[model samples]
Target: MGVCPECRAATYQMRQGKLREEDCLRCGWLAIVGADGTCRCCRAAVRLGEDPAWLRAVLERRLLPAGRPLQLALRMDGLRLKTLPLRQTRPLTTVKLPSWARGRPAELQDDPCVCVTEVPGQLGLFAPCPRSFTREHGTRIRGRTPVEWPIVLAELKAIAAERGVGETWLVHTGDGARLALASRPPTERLVSPEALVDLPQMRPTVQLVLQRAGLLARPRPRLVPGWWSKGRGSCRDCLAWTNGNDQRCRDCQMWGHTHADGPCHRCGRGLPLRDGHCRRCLLLLAETEYDLDHIALEGGDQLWFGGPYAPHLKTTTNRAGEQTGLYGRRRLQTKRRIAVQTSRATAHTVSEHLAIPGQLLLFHALRDWSRLDGRPLPALTPNAEALLADFTSHIRARGWTLPGNQASLSALKFLVAHLGADAPFHETDVRLLAHHPNFAAPRVINYLRAIGLLVPDEKSDALLATARRYADEAPAAFQDGVHRWIDVMCNAGTRPSLPLAPSTVHGYVRRARTCLNIWHTVGIDDLRAITADHITTVLDTLTGETRKTTATAVRSLFRALKREKLIFRDPTRGITLTVAIPLPKALPDERLVGALDLLPFARDKLSLTLAAVHALGVHDQRGLLLDDLDRARGRLTVRRAGRLDRTIYLDELTHQLIKKWLAERHRRWPSSTNPHLLVTARTSADDNHPKVHPRAISKPLSRIGLQPGRLRMDRILDEATHTEDPVHLIRLFGLSPITAMRYVRAAHPDRYRPLPIAP
Candidate 1:
């Protein structure tokens, strides 16, 4: 009864005129009934309008014997039936093509005698003879001559003669089409050029050809009443904006070149655009807009972009796509998605990406950012466009992909709010901004640092802040001595052979502060008052590792005070107690089993593997650089105390993981400028080569129920148990002699008995 939607073959729809029988509505395919189910033609192509009986009769006649099948095809355009068997291709019959619907009117043919061209300002859009394809698509043109060519040709020829321009250019044709387009009945869009880039009729390419040939008007600069904004203030002479608004203003106004600009086009102020049409106009517009639930941006197709700029949005519509109207609940069906269509867009098209008011405000900010900074942005996509989208719907910011994910937009917001009279501020100037809880500045700082817009920090703010916090917690009288110790420990002033790490310094002061706090509660706060008996009592209160670490901390505190002459005697002296060396236990076989396999990221897998198999410390893992991993040589160099201490070589697993992780890292952060091997979204934007934070290296391991410190110790202890020799442990792991001895002692307790148990 009808053609099948799929397969497009002619098929019966009902059986016995009572029940639906031929096949399902969707495919119209009934492969078999009882025995004969196969249909080869359906698989190859649709056979429309052919009588089933006729086709079968023809097929039987064409067969030579009880032989192979012949392939059949119909050339739709030519209405010829053809057959192919082995080698020869020949037509079998000529048939009329049948269809119920009307065919499209014939496409416009190009007329070489007529000119073709592009509309001067609109891109992708040609000077039609073009009908729009979709309300949604970008500028794309369809070019062909008009249906009423004879009349249009006569008109074009007359115009060409009058204008003294050649007939080959499309601009002239464009003029002809413009005059004739409306009168010609609405039909298929076929844009003709007088704007030929729109015909693409090239003799070949010359920009502004007709205008250059003096066939059309060329734009010239406007000369106005006050071309220069030389002076500001109400004029006493004419009681208007200009004192000279006397005669020339009237003349310019009459001619309409009127640089002789007048009062508030809205407010009657001399302002070119008084208060941008004043609060009164805004309220009036708001009153009207409030009545409607939905206002359609005519022919508006939305797109989304990512950019790094102050990201606060002034919502014309909420996230749900409802306008800010007092009445009406009408909502649009479509939602805005991050635009993946980064294929180049036009100046007009880019503005469509942002909300309307945001579009208006963002451009002004961008103009200020560009003009004030004295640096024009380079290309914007894949990076700056998105960054500043929350900032500019027009001009784009050009740089690497915005420095962060969700926080990146907010980061720019902070930077813009803090920008001074002179932009690209120093890291110190940005310090105040970074403290806001809602504002994330580090990612933007990393991006700015990469672009050479912000100066690098001399001393990282986090480090300085942490030190200051600990120093402030010291007991009042002991603060002076404590600051001195901290300064010495941080290598702030005079150089010592070795300086303690920030964590180590914190540990020392933290423990010392605990003792001081306890003593303060007991009213024996001063260092001079802390006698040996007080030290013994405090040491008695703490046990095991806590006792040992606290004793070390107290002794260091007293030693510093005595050296500084703040105390006469070191109460912690001669108060030493022997502590047992703790043995590293191997992780449970079950816990270690398949842990790496569970980690989600390649970077995490490699990080945990090095900690568990190779015994890398948290700091060591953070310090690893891209250049440190020598894949070809199967070597990984570890930096210790700013010097290369050991080269780990000889492993396939390490190499495999390194390869996988590097690939993943690069895939995720292709534009990363970080020199460090480990880069997260946080650190990838900076070229400064900041090491991955120690917590970053350990946190993932902790999340999956693993501990880097314990895992690392387990590795070393396992190695020591197998080797048994302390010297081997020292040499292989680059461990200190004392450290190796302790590990060896733990491994072979049979050789070194613990203190005899008092039975």
Candidate 2:
């Protein structure tokens, strides 16, 4: 071995690593290099003082954002690393109709706006946002539809010849069909295309091609009025003036014609006939068959009832639950394919708001609610009575306010109606059944669990939901590890420490997910595959507080895994982190100094006084009782969380504010049973013993662009400026030792303000 070095010295060569020859990435010259194909020629050129313009240009292109996608992407194809040209999707280009085509409907131009699309032998004519455009002059949407240069050039040549606005015009020479867009009405929002129901057309394949060319933006759904129909909310429930002279809806008109000189031929009843049958008969016919618009008689086809422009009946629901439609119609709709279907738009799409059924019955077997089926709610069962009694007791025991207590009961009733008589209840089903005005899912679940009607199967909160969502993206083993970690955080007695709050667990999961995502990008998914080096690499990418948060979350995950013996070793065992808390600054004098004068209520004024002057947190102020305030001693005692109560001598301003509030509180609730020093009508009106929520003390201040915590910090900081003692702050504000120390350090002149940590 020693003699080999002497022989190798005579060869005079450098052996860097096991290598393969590859073409230089930048230049055509062959180079002895690694798999990346990085060569010395480019480096040598730069070292020899060649212009770096090419390098600078490449860097900008790589680092800077190009609004459109890049042409080439570095990807691995099979075993080979290759830069492939990306497939760029073409977007739609919108153009107006030809001059020959008419724009809007004839009646008032009846809500005018002619929008149309066409394919070979088929044309789609639409009148969108007719209500808006009927009288107003045309307004243009700001975004421009991007067109291919070659196509645009040809289109412009024809437009230029005709001296037209090329962007808004499209003319088909072979078919002599042209669509000319007019400036009829200006719309602030995106418009949905409403089909010209009378003007029939269908060519789905060709439609797709044309749509791909003309669409600039696919707008999120907005309220666009239905054409030639009653579209307002009032109209859906027969609240608007009747269309078809006397008919409740288009469905009713189609059901039977009114007094067509005899009784209905089908039902043989002497009533106003629609399509030669009674309204009920026609509705019955619709359920069993299609083509109800044109009824067939023995002699000839029945006349079309009502005109095409009648309003459809509004969908509705009651105690039977909000139904989209019957299962028979739902299954049929799913199997449906594109045909010459009319483009219809209507509000009340959800139909949950229609608490009462409409007069007209909608056909087609979709939706359960019909005017005939609308029935009164059923009586509560013995079980339901017992459940409500127990739930009410539970609510009172927990000290729920009047509104909160009522909402839980209402939510239960809704679920009962939704499930009908026999369907079992689940936490998710309860959540989904809750409608607008009162989303009473969480409270309802608490009631159900307390009564033992439902088991706890779902994630208790949003944090677990969020963690589970991200965990699903990982490998099965890694996902199991994540969920296991969550179980530890959520379940009691899983750790020596008290169980994590939903919010805390949620935050931890979110941070852990961030690390997992970064690791997965580098081909690592399993927790066992991850090393301390991998964690270090992820930490380096995040800075300051983010880095610390990510580190803590990662360490927690690894620690949990190691504790359960799920992993061989904890990668985070040797890692130690020191994350600084950001300094708090005083609020501007102009903002807080005159806030008291601006405040309208005595309660609000006192709330501000406690926060800004006495350094009392919103929680502390909300928890204060009349007994806690000693007017003779001029002292105020603040109690928050489970900490020791802190008593302080009141300032003259605080005392004056308290005096004003005491007088007001006495006037407002003369017979109130609430023992709290500050009580609102909500807590005072009822003897339910419900305490004031933190929002009561904070909302008024929040509305005026002030925060209680921020004001408390400013007050504490002002005191800390006088003396740098943490113990003094703790005794004065009843802050925990840690928080008090943080306040002192933040206010120190030697300390510089850093970015605020997220939590």
Candidate 3:
């Protein structure tokens, strides 16, 4: 038996000689089966070691009291016994003892008396009397109030027996009332037979009960050994073994302690080394080299690094390895160096060469020179640069008006091609050629002519020549031509001689004629006579009324010619009638009347007014007068017995006779609406009717006579013709100016005679 370390008491052992018996002989610890087959000490019971059979028998008992106060005690020989009330707050009732303890003898007298001490206030102690605690008594105790003492003791003993602690032990309180003590330590209680049989079986039942009550324990994390530590390994940095340790290794002191060799050149801290250089130092070196190269390559300078004569050098002296061949590498390196040097040199060259100051060469190259040369080249000399600058300035200042002089235009073309290949030559070049101070206008004109840039027509030749003669002494001929051409084309759209209406075509013909006349007078044979054919052809080709309406148009031409003093009638070939017609009376009857009304002319002042009224025949009396003259002529012919009668109507006929003559004559003149009469010869084919042309109506009146100027001629012919009634004369002879003037002179000879009466 093992001794209890805390109590210094010898432990009880199971007695093999007795069935289910355990006793402590030295300490006088004794327990007998009062209700269970186990020894008890100090009012508690303890089991000897039990097999499945005994444990099963022990559990089958109803151990806890039903309604009364009851107490249970468990004790071991060497350890302190534990005493607990089966019913903490209620009274205990008698319970049936297990069958395993029914035939067992009690040994309470031989065992040491365990002192019974009362706990203060509520907790009480009870003792069992073997006689009072019979089965019948147990049943009766269930109904008793405040519990029967013997039954209570028996219930407590039953609880102790069920828990496998003997009921022989007594329960008592410590002297200070702070604790309660049992005379003996507790015996080992039996675990469930179910638990001992299968832990898996018991676990699920236990877990289910606990879960239902919400008291289930959390599942512990599954740990895989060697995969991750479960409170068992050192920190990662430490190289030490940590089978079950939490701290890091002493050597490293940190979580990670992987070693690296190189330190940073700039920061002086150990850093990861790669490709023979620390990361920081490598970056620093690369940046430093880049900055150095950038600075050295900038501006107009060349620089080298990591070589002899360089300010900074990098070398590996200890390792006597073969040196890289400098030939090929140097060629590549030298090529780059040469490129940099060439670029810098080109920049400097351009700065020195170009005339314009403060202009960067590289920018000029990109903006201007590259486009000029297809790529940048060595710069121009200062002279060439000045020429270029001056040329460009001239071009910008003059614009398209720059001269096309051989030297100047050639230089401009070259410069423009160099600077702006796509720019067009402007009209300013022609203007400049015409007006430039250094060049003669003729020479410039000649050059423009040679290039087909200027063509001198009749209109432009005079101005052009004038420009040339004046040459360097005058303003630009080309500019003058531009203005003049604009005016001519813009304004010259009409002329009278043109085939179009006089109003529509007059201006054009006039301008052409003017230009032609000017050219001819100026001794320009090529321009002379150009517009003559154009005018004549235009008139000849006219196809409408101007061509077909000969009578009306001849009348207009007669008036036009008379007004212009271009009319000449000899009367040797044909009778002549000379008149000075005003512009209002110059048109044909229709137009003349329109002009008369439009002009508001008085009747007396109108020269062709009577002719208009007579031709239009608005009055009946004119037709009656002509009819009477015809009838009187017929009467005289009959009176003379078929001889032609030379005398016709009376010189001064009555109004009715004149009215009847006009009415008769009005039937002959198809258009006769005025009171007028005239004879026209009839054709054989038209024996019944007279065929008289309006123009021929006045022909016989002019020739109405015998004896070289007979009665008809003598009656109507006079130099200064006058009449008492000019209106009557207007009705007679169709009242045409030519016919009326002849009659008026014949009738009033004295008034018309030579105007010599003043002598």
All candidates: TM-score: 0.49, 0.41, 0.13
Worst 10 residues of 1 by lDDT: 132-141
lDDT of 1 by residue, 1-759 (tens): 332232223222121111122321112343311111113333232244333443363454331111123234544665543211211222243422222111212443333323334343434332224332111111111235344544445555565577678745445345434332322223323322333333222212222333333333233354343434345433331223333424323322332341233454444544222234422232333333333334323454112121221111221567887645322222211111112122222221222122222122322221122222422212333333444563332112323444334455554643443332123545654554455555556655656665556766577546545655676886686676678767766665344535676667778887877777778788865678889988898889989999999898878778766765778888877886977755677788898888988889888888888888888888788878888878878888888885438778847887888899888877777767677878876677554667778888789888878999999889899998887688887767778888897888788889887658612
Model 2 agreement with the true structure over 1-759: per-residue lDDT tens digits: 111111132222212123323333344334443233333434344334353653453434321111211122223347432221111211122323233232223232212233322233432356533222210121221111222323433544554467654333332220111111222123322111332111112223213322433522253475544554553222221223433434355554443342353576765656655446654444444433443243444554233233353323222345777523321344233322111132112111222322232234353222222331333334454555566566677666645555755666776764454343233355655665454345466667655655555535545566667777877866555788888887777763245655777778878888888787778778885788889899898898889888988888889899888877788999999877666656789889888767888899999999999888888787677778888889999997776555676887998998999999999987766666678887887787544446788899899999889999999889998998888888988887777897887777777858645439633
Number of backbone-clashing residue pairs for each candidate, in the order shown: 36, 24, 74
**Candidate 1 at residue 745, lDDT?**
77
Any runs in candidate 3 off by more than 4 Å, and if so which?
Answer: 1-378, 382-534, 537-759
Each model's lDDT comes to 0.52, 0.55, 0.32
Residue range with the least summed lDDT across 10 consecutive positions in model 3: 172-181
Candidate 3 per-residue lDDT, tens place, 1-759, comes to 321121212222122111222332112223321223223332233232223333343355333321221124443567755422222222232444443333223421221222233343433233211111112211222222221234334444454456565423312100101011111112212122222112212234333333333333355364454434456653332123443354543333321233355664544555444344543234334334434345433333332221122221122223566422212233334555666667665574432222233333353121222233333334445544554465445434432244443455443333333333222222333344334343333323333343433435234434434423332332232233222322333343232331223332233322333333344454445311233333343345444544333222223323333333333531112312233332111222332333323422221112122223222221221222333345444421112223332232333223243444345444443442222243332221121233335334333223321111122233233312444665565444334565565455545656766546322
* Candidate 3 residue-wise lDDT at 544: 50
Runs with alpha carbons beyond 4 Å of true place in candidate 2: 1-376, 379-433, 436-475, 490-498, 573-581, 625-635, 640-642, 659-699, 702-705, 724-726, 736-759
Supply the TM-score for candidate 1.
Answer: 0.49
